[model samples]
Target: MKIFEMLIPMTWEGLKVTMSVFAITLIVSLPLAIFVALLKGSKNKYIYKFTSAYIYVMRGTPLLLQLMFIFFGFHYIPVIGYAFTRYQAIYIAFILNYTAYFTEIIRGGINTIDIGQFEATKVLGMSKSFAFTRIILPQVMKNIIPSLGNEIITLVKDTSLVYILGVTDILKAAKSVSNTYSTFTPYIFVAFVYLGIIAIMTNILSSIESKFDYYR
Candidate 1:
């Protein structure tokens, strides 16, 4: 009971760190992903190639490796190295990694949209922007909701990787308590904490998915 009391506040602190990373990553990445997806589909070959290369590099690497490189490796650079804090490094890595993923997911959703819809919009003499905002984007979002939800859930778990940088996320907090008390109960408690988070996210995502069911 004493250990459980101790675990509660430490785990809550760690959960705050995890939630900050997840929320910031999602909020920042979503718009960037939309922009990148559009760039990937642009008529300008240079823009298309650059965005494609970025996506390839980001998606090709393991996120854990990326986090390490950003947090550790960047410190070796001449001028920019000194600017990165641990949290900054983690946020940069998470945003960049998830942006590539969200871009690809959005691109796939865009591609799966029927070409005839674009033609119909053009026939109606609507501007391209209008058509996309009014007609195409809604359907694309509907198609991609499930994939996006999976990524969000993954992000929650991935927050644990911040421990690599000594960021004191939930797992790290639990480990700290476990070490101090010489008991495994902290780990068990943290496991339930994580499970509770996942369950809540699953429920919320399911509700959002239901809102899009009208698309079908």
Candidate 2:
């Protein structure tokens, strides 16, 4: 087989890892974001204070630092004793980082709904939770889709950071292939892989936006 044909399976394998991270991040982060948004929006001072500090620490620090800290830092802990593997560490790090960002986006989305809407919901005998599900969340998601698209694209590229913990994702696969072939072809192919993933995501998000435009 030609070198390009050989690259097909390796590149496909790497792409799977990258997509897995993206899927896991979204699945875990979306609901966590809603809870975090509620915490930040709560009337209780302690709840708000705790969430504020949590967001502050998460946003103020670098994701790479957080990842390294958990991945390697856990190894030094007396109890856990290196039970977590690199892929697990990377997944956890990305999930935490994405959840924080998603919370902010959701908060903004929720705020975009006019207070009059809530008042109207109350007048119509809707409970806060019911109104949020029936009216608020739909509108919030519409507003947040653009931001979500950006975050998802960033996640695609950010999976490369997994290499720091020795996870052989698409970018790392490219490196391995490059080292073996002594050429830049592998890296070029990996770029296309990333590009393809982003392009497909962009199209999917764009379609969602278009479908939701009627609600705007």
- Candidate number with greatest TM-score: 1
Tens-digit lDDT string for candidate 2 (42-93): 9999999988888888788988898899888988999877757778888888
lDDT for model 2, on a 0 to 1 scale? 0.87
TM-scores of the models, in the order given: 0.95, 0.93
Clashes per prediction? 0, 0
Question: Tens digits of per-residue lDDT for model 1 on 91-206?
Answer: 99999999999999999999999999999999999999999988998899999999999999999999999999889889999999999999998898889999999999999989
Clashing pairs in 1: none
Question: Which one is best on lDDT?
Answer: 1
Off by over 4 Å in 1: none
Error of 2 at 108 (Å): 0.9
Give candidate 2's error at residue 188 in angstroms: 0.9
Could you tell me the lDDT of residue 35 within candidate 1?
Answer: 90
Q: Which ten residues in a row have the lowest lDDT in candidate 2?
A: 1-10
